[model samples]
Target chain A: MPLIVKPTPAHPEPPAHKIMPAFATRFGPKLAGEVAATDRLVRVNALTALCDALSDPEQAHGCADAGVVETLNAHVSGGQDAPTRVLAAKALCGCARDARAARAMVDAATPAAIQGACLNDAEQDVRMHCYDALIRLGGGPRRGASSIVAAGYPKALVEKAEKESVGLQPRALDLLTSCLGNEQGLAEALDAGGIATCLSLLGSMEAAVRAAAGRCLAGLCFDMSAKDAAVEADAVDTLCALLEDPDLGARRAACAALVSVTTTDEGKRRMVPAEPRPRDAVAAIIALLAEPDAYLTTTACKLVANVAVHPKVRAQLREDKECLPAIDALIAGPGTDQDALVAQHARIAKDAVLWEP
Target chain B: MANSAYTHTTSPKPLLSKMKKTTYRAEDEENIITNNIMFDRRVVRGNTYAAQVVTHNTQREVERMRYESERTLRRDATCQRKERLAKPSTPPPAEGRAHIKAQTDTFLEELSDRPVESEAVTQTEAILDRPPSPLFIPSKTGVDKETDIPGGDLFDFDIEVKPILEVLVGKTLRVSMMEVMEEAELDAIQRRQMEFEQMRNAELVEVQRLDAEASRRFAEKQRRFTQETDRLRQQAELGQKVAARAFARSYLANLSELAFDQLEDSGHFVDPVEKEIQDSFIPWLFDSVVETTNNHISSSSCVDALIVDAIELASNLQSDVIKQIKQKERARVFAVEDAQEIKEAEGTAK
Candidate 1:
């Protein structure tokens, strides 16, 4: 017998918006009808079809308008078999891409349902789908984020990110980033060793995962303790190393994370190494000032301003040829030519770089 | 006529002296001059034309004439009635003096009956007017100049609206780009979720297959266990049977040989004569022969011993008999001789 290699499944192109009405009208009633079937196979089939249809945002929006989120919420909180529940959770996750559907899902207590299923179910696939759905559905609003925190989702996400497949790590990290939207979720994630997990994943071989981890670290560093922990873990050096990464996303995320890190005084001091180094963090941030992306340039300026508080970094800025010019150009740039926030932070960086202290 | 002319007002005083003093109280005056009699200024009489066109002086003259005529008639009637009383109680002292005294006294009485009055006679200065207020002089300090600038020169609408337009354009572009990015993100997440669903489905199938395989293996193990148990039990039973059979055969072999040997050794298979002799005749013949031999030998021994003893006794007896015979013969011979000698010896012995 020869080896049989399975081809990667091709993603379907979504139908045009004109057809969504008809698609929704056809699938909506069918889903509602079969979702309540006495036979498990019928319910599972219905859920699979719903999951497939929910992949298109237009279709998802139509389904939400047709009240499919409520039906899925029932299965999430029901005593259905793992496969059926998995399909329901997957469908809910896809539906969440539509903002209205996400809102509808949250209003339907889908987060609480997915949290329950994710926690209580013994099956890995079921738990994973529930996790995915919660990631898409839970941290949207303050109420849902609080509920997710109360359900201990951050700890579970951290654990899954730590132990699950590489494909799932970035998603879990992104969910953790969302969890950091609120203080309670941030505190919960921190208590669940989120800093360590994010810092460790910063060394991931996959650039996407590294970028996601960097983003999560950036979010986590909003807390004072997380900043201290990051500094203590030598994450400053690690992120500085990541500043040279080939992937722009990883670099941007690292830059954002470094910005968060530099908010604290210790992080500021850490930005300027005591010894001579090959790659200077301050110079790297100054170099980022010339990038065309306003967000990157803005974030880089913010990081520079934060670290320029240190006299050593200020001296380094004075020694560097391009730092002041770039910052001056940003400050002198016309309002129409540059982002307001970028110009504002560039002015702040200039002031800090030129300060005597 | 001369007396009348000389009668100065004493007569009028007499006519009034008889009259009762009817001083109107404030209340009575209000009652007598009721609102019906007192015309309201706002009331329009039926002859509106006459009321409206009537001059103030004419209306006053009419009112005065109507009251004056009534008063004159009432005064004349009272005067006529009091004419008798008009004569003084005493004749007038002198006409002129009486008239003078009467007029003076009437004037004093009238003065005494009048209400308290204050008369203010203001003598305004004739045409004493304040000098006309000095005419305000129109004075102008600064020159009034006006200049007209065209609306275009003041501001160009296009230029003025440029910054606003740029802001609007920038805001619109930013919002649209953000929307596009959001849409792409949603599409990406949707695609990822779909792929996850597929992977999850495959994993589900694989898990189910593994579960089925596990159950099948468990059933196979149970069947094998039962077969092994049955084989062990049969082996034990067969071993037990073999050991029992071998032990029984070994035990019965010695028993059968012992039985046959004992039967043959007990002499039940001997010949009839040998069997009879051995059983009864042998013992009988031996006992009889032994007894006869014993009897014969005893008799013969007894006879032989008796013969030898008799022979010896006979010899002794023969010898003794011989001696006795000889002695007897000798005694007889000797008796004859001894008779003679015995007679002698008997005689000697006696």
Candidate 2:
């Protein structure tokens, strides 16, 4: 006779039902399980689901618990198919938004892995996804940006920004921006001719690409050599021209880049050259002071402060009927209740303009 | 033959040299017998035919035989000791009673010195006040029961489980609804967060615009004010720098001072305090006092006129009211007469 065995319930009482969002209950484990399956089609379907689910930040935060990050990381690092890897990278890009998952990915060396994939992946789309993931994971916990820089992604990003199509160029520049926070990253970006590429992109028709390029150049200007290289690349003219762009973001970024460019003494001198009777750079900055954007105005005020340190620039500003009065008005404090940050910087500019040798 | 018992060989057998001998003393050479010397058979010693026993034992053999004998004796002794130990010693006098008797308890004195009697005495312990109640055994009552009741007969499954099923369904529905509510709350919060961010960005842009506008207007106002101040100063400077004014000022630079000094010396400047009091101060004070008096009179007269006009107006209003009352009385009488006449006419016509 067959032996009759009593079956034991895992719990004496039914477990208190966990009230989870229906989507989490439905997709959380299914995605993880299918991703863990050895079958390629199953993983692809699961990753596609994950990519779709991750578009919602709430789900992205919830997806970390599904243990899909490790599996996605495996697909990225392992010799998976390009589309699968691309999907994995895209999912990781979403997952990287979650702090805990981002820390996990960084600790697991996923940034380096993604950097490697971005460089080595044959498919352009896969590379793009990897770059996106890397950029997201960059500058996060565990010195994520330094790790990407250490992985030599900066030069690669610069090169890609230079050679890639308009669509991909912004991503590359964004990656460069994320990576080029330190001196070494800045050096690598500079050595890769990033300044020239960014200067060229300053005139791009795409506002986003121009903004990205402007941000990259702005980031590069933090280092002395990189700043000098950018100034030498005639970036001032391009950046000054960008100040008039219709896009607010591009204009702000250009203003910021010019601010960074004028940080050094040489940059200051370059901003207000001695030779020309008409210096459009200073005029562009002066014009920005009148812009409706207080942030841009504040930045223009800072640029003026930096530029007005030059005696010649100060004299020229005093000579310009509009520049000094506008600055004086800013210095005079807001007639209404507003942010005094702009007024404060304007005072500094006024002081600098009025400063003697 | 005895005298020729010593035999000599012409060649010497190989032998060790004694040239490095430690002793210097000499001894009789012929007394030492060498292997070269031989004794003749005719010169035999007494009892040569006696038996010569050949001993077969070497030192090693003798030692081996002695060790074997010693090992046998040691083994026998060890076996005997082991047997003696294993013999159990005659059962220890039946649980060592005799040994225990021979031993003395330290707390109880042996008292062997005292004579002991052989008589035995009995000692008893009183019984417990009450023996513990006898172990309880529940007595059997009715006959042992065994009923084979069908499960359905014991309880109605559907009727009994309805509440539980209801609870389960209710709990499930409540939990699902709660989950949906939580998700909706999260979504709303997220949407609010996004809206807040967008609002913040837009507000920042607006604030910047407003600030810029304020600054520009302020700057323009300041510029225009500065221009006005500069223009005024320039006009003043231009007036001072006019050729006629310059020539006149140059020609009369010290003349006004001299003339004013000479006039002051001649008492022509006068006592300004006295001059002000007599000429302008007195006249102004007198005119103000007279004008104040005149204003008061005119104002009082005007007030009297207004009072008189008010009285006349009040009187006229009273008279008009009386006339209107009288006219109303007359009209009422007339209306009554007309009504009466109309009534009479109606009667006559009827």
Candidate 3:
């Protein structure tokens, strides 16, 4: 006699996909399977636990390898409820923080889902997370903005950036900087007035905003046309003005940018505006060399190298003979990583000084 | 000065030139690892400065720089305010928006009033509805028109003689001579084309000879240009090196000359930025700096430079932390939005 059991049918289960084995012991099949479970509560519990486990840097890589990215992506991007989707996206965000995991998601379905949420999702938090996820993956804040600016010169984008929030504007300019990393990008940046916009932002009230603008300015100095544009925009004077700022971070960033601007012919010509004898920056920048700041010293040395290309600036530097011993001291000092950066620039600038005319 | 005892060495092989791998001295490495600020210039050259001197110089320099920058910022802000007061008041937002819309869309306004973007390219104008030509007699006559239309005379009348002459003489010598001359000279249009090709060939030969000479001249010019550029570059490099060293020396001199006060009783203004810098960045900076400078038990450091670097590092750290937190929050929000989308989709599926 066989006892027949009739199955009660109410909620139909999803078709099961082939399950991949979890590589790590802590997140074996049971936890992994729980994320894919049809039961909502079970999935949530598993996701939260896995997300917590991922907080430890030691476990991030292993979890990513355990195929958690795909499951998280599905939960985040698939037909999960708002709260569940939020939790899943948060967990995915944690994963995105780790570069390797971010890359894994990039190859998976995460980007499209994240982008979709950023664009179409009604919730502000959800839109924000999508933007964060994209940035974590080095795809920039707004991929559309990045790609649009990338497609041609950044004219409209720079104008659009001006009206945006302080944070978004800098990011947009930074996006322009990335776009300007190549020769073509340089051409495009020139077309977009990147130099002018960045120079304008150099005087921003916010230190963070100024730093971003300075960074973009530094990037633009790499190409000839852009360098020419920068010259026209009075970048040298503006950058030098920033060197005198009270904030050391902005000053250092400004000095770093000055290093690039001063490296070119146009940069040298514009080092001091066509003003009275030499510019005040020549002295202010020289003063920076004596400071203990590694970044400032490095850039100051490089700026001097560029400015010294002008005989007037060179004469000024020569008049102040102590720079020789100062640079010499840096070269012969105990070599730390910071020392290496300072010493390298100091050495190059020193040679430029020591070169017999 | 304490720096005099160090006996600075000049390696004819320029330091940091060409950016080769850095060669570190073993003693230097040991000093770094041990965090010992030896009396060595490389370890700590500013040990000569008295503690009082270091403090005085740092405080004085920071105050002066702060004062100068603040004064300038205030001046600029006030000037802007003054300008705003002088100008007419801006319209209210709703009115302003309406004004902007009107300005953009009103077609009857002066064309000059339209604000053109500097880099914007103009779209090419297109002809939408070109009319068909009545005399488009296509040149693609696959079959000879004379054979198809039996109308040789219609087109052949281009150089016809009178009908009376043709009937009276029936191909007289004068008429035959005119026809021979026309055939020999070729069509007037055809003759011009042949002449042009011949003239062009002669001109081309002459042009080729001139081009060869010009190319030689160009090559010479290029060589001179290259040589001149090289010379200028070399000179520029020399000047740059000189300037770099000079700037460093002057800077060090200024650092050394902090005469109890770098400012000669510079007038003071109210200090506001100082508090923000101290509260947010300076204390943490001192914490890290204590460790950085701690390595040198006996060695002394320049407080002026140290404070600046510490301040910079602290400022950068704060910026980095802020960015990190913002990123984290945004990532979470985006993920939730994506999940919500999925949820909506699922509901529809159900």
Model 2 C-alpha lDDT per residue in residues B315-343, reported as the tens digit of each score:
67646644644464455476777656655
Sliding window of 10 residues with minimal summed lDDT for model 1 chain B: B10-19
For A1-357, candidate 1 gives per-residue lDDT tens digits of 212233334557653221222354565665556665657777777677667667666666667877778777777778777777788778877776567788777677676666666655666676667667666665444466666666677887787687766766777787777677667888888999999999889999999899989888887877768888999998899998888788877887888788777666688788777775688777677778898766668767767766776787888888899998998888776776446657877886787688772
lDDT of each: 0.70, 0.69, 0.61
**Tens digits of per-residue lDDT for model 2, A259-351:** 777665677677665556343767777888788777677778777776776777778787888998888777676554444767877887787
Residue-level lDDT tens digits of model 3 in A1-357: 211222233455543332333455655445566777887777777777766665555567777776778887777667677766777777776776666676567556565545445444555455445545543444323333344334443554455546546655555555455455345556666776777788888889888678768766776765546666777778878888888887776786687677666555567777656675334777787778888876568667776666675777777677776777787887876889779867877886787666555
Fnat, model 3, is 0.00
Question: On residues B1-350, what C-alpha lDDT tens digit does candidate 1 reach at each position?
Answer: 47541333223111111123324322222233223412443233353233335444455557656876797679778977899687767666775565333554534544365687755354433433433344344454222335555445444668879999999999999988877797798779765663343233323323333453466468779988999999999999999989988988897879867877787687556678887997789888888888888887888788877877887787677677667556755775867765465445435533
**Candidate 1 deviant stretches above 4 angstroms:** A1-30, A52-86, A98-104, A116-132, A139-141, A332-338, B1-350
lDDT accuracy of residue B236 in candidate 1: 99
Q: Is candidate 1 or candidate 3 better by TM-score?
A: 1
Model 2: CA > 4 A from native: A1-30, A52-67, A77-83, A119-125, A273-279, A329-338, B1-350
In model 3, which runs have C-alpha deviations exceeding 4 angstroms?
A: A1-50, A56-92, A109-113, A116-136, A139-164, A167-193, A276-279, A321-325, A354-356, B1-350
Model 3, position B49, has a per-residue lDDT of 30
Clashing pairs in 1: B338-B342
lDDT of 2: 0.69
Best by TM-score: 2
- Candidate 2 lands at a TM-score of 0.45
